[model samples]
Target: MTPFFASAASFVDPLDEVSAQMHDVTSKPLRDIVVAGERLVAVGDNGLIIYSDDHGQTWLQAAVPVSTDLNAVFFSDPLKGWAVGHGAAILHSTDGGKSWVRQLDGRTLEALFVDYFEHRSGLDTERAQSYLSALLSMTRPGPGQFFMGVWFDKAGTNGYAVGPFGLILGTQDGGKTWQPGNTSIDNDDLLHLTGVRQIEGALYITGERGRVWHLDQSSKRFVMGEVGYDGTLFGITGRDSTLLAYGLRGHVFRSIDAGRSWASVSNDFAAGITAGTAVDGSGLVLVSQAAQVAISRDEGTTFELLDVPRPTLYTGVVSMTGGQLAMVGLNGVTTLQIQ
Candidate 1:
């Protein structure tokens, strides 16, 4: 049964109250969207969660417990799913996205980080100061908690959630418990982490100032890799050995040798590429903040433009049934078929 859930807004601290009912909720601000088997789920501002089982022809709101802005969402399958956003909120849904329960929130996450880092600092005095510094600034108890990206494995056993200030959390037992990454990340500057994704079996994090970090399997530590740009990279997507990292001011870089070396791929028209995905294995679709769409037929080698019916700031996108796409942005959900 679909509970009479609120629209996107109606709360005290956003975490203090459940969403309330509102009309035309699908037109509210949305940030991210993903495809879960036949259903398409989209989340955005004011804790909005809407899903469509019929290729986005219609929408239905989920019973969400909090009203905080949801930043990213992922589903390991059609049933088990997760969404992370502001206030250190991580939500899980057992039966698709019909209903959700809070897994982690600001109330409990602060102390968990303190305990983990304090213990870690005691074991390694050389990095103790670093850990302590991070403990105070990164894990401070308060209402401001933002997790920008999240992803889980196919079996829904292991997952990672990333956020601002170099914060990363991992869960092994299906999100029963989550822990701070064990090893110190190479981001000494503690740049804000924008996204967490897997590329060719390697876990990578994209962040500020064109910084990209990949976990070293042997050391289990994240280390920096250059993608030949110095602007904030919003995200990355690729197929096989070809990778594309895009960001501010219409800049995009491609790494053909598995990130060993990168060359310029940016063009004059592209501007602030925000969300991207690989479709049909070979085709790539990328959308920018300028409401522009670029399609790459041959991996990330080159791109061509596509027209949008109405231009708006596009934040996230996912391929839809047939040759269409379901995208979420400032004005809400917009579905367009590839032409």
Candidate 2:
């Protein structure tokens, strides 16, 4: 019999290279940031994952198993977390952000998706065929697609990951297995699903063409929840009944009914709002790619401009203890003592 180590080294994907251990990781270009209890966790290009226990004062690199460009990171709780990235990679961590093991990658995800849909019934012919074609095409020599966002419940037993072309996957057994939920979604045009988050008591999925898909409790399917905008929504944020849909060109819409309906609560900034975090359900802070900050104290009903001090192509932000925030993007991590 072949040795265990020898068998494992039989094949490898180029993008599956492990992340490098580097000094001063804060100088790296990070893509997403999240607050994990008292520590702050961040992920970025080339499968980089780092954590800071002293609230972004200094950083420690984690042992990441892939070199893919991680686009988003989410923590269900302080100790359980997950990160998604290019190549359809999904990574899980049980000890906060200290380390990660590859849970799903393109190779495994391709087979899982194809098999799930092939056996699924009652799905439209076109959607099923579309998914199969994409899967086949992406199964080529490289990481063909990305899973942009990931989220899990507090119990860490349920979660979903979303990406372009209406792609969404859910796992009930804590990501031990995932099912393709894209076909069940009412996205006829195959709109790219950019973000997914549970606002209040409802699960909301955002995507291109100003579309919002809400999980129907009875039907267990995603149905359209229109917000009446024509641009792409990058993400959704809120706590309680209040929700905010962030889109291109600094456009933000507010929903007080768990995303059932929205009203124009635009922030008159010209740059794209990339990331935001709620301040204990009472307020929100948004960051733009053009180094701008918008703060709202009245549950996203109105907003006021704040300062970012340094210009960075901001992509993610999280609320920390006290009146402070941690942001990550092209310029790595920056902590602001928001007042």
Superposed by TM-score, candidate 2 places the C-alpha of residue 310 at a distance from the truth, in angstroms, of 2.1
Candidates' C-alpha lDDT: 0.82, 0.83
Candidate RMSDs in order: 5.1, 5.1
Cα error of candidate 1 at position 162, Å: 1.0
In terms of lDDT, the poorest run of 10 residues in model 2 is 134-143
Q: What is the lDDT of candidate 1?
A: 0.82
Worst 10-residue lDDT window for candidate 1 reads: 2-11
**Which one wins on TM-score?**
1
Off by over 4 Å in 2: 1-14, 120-142
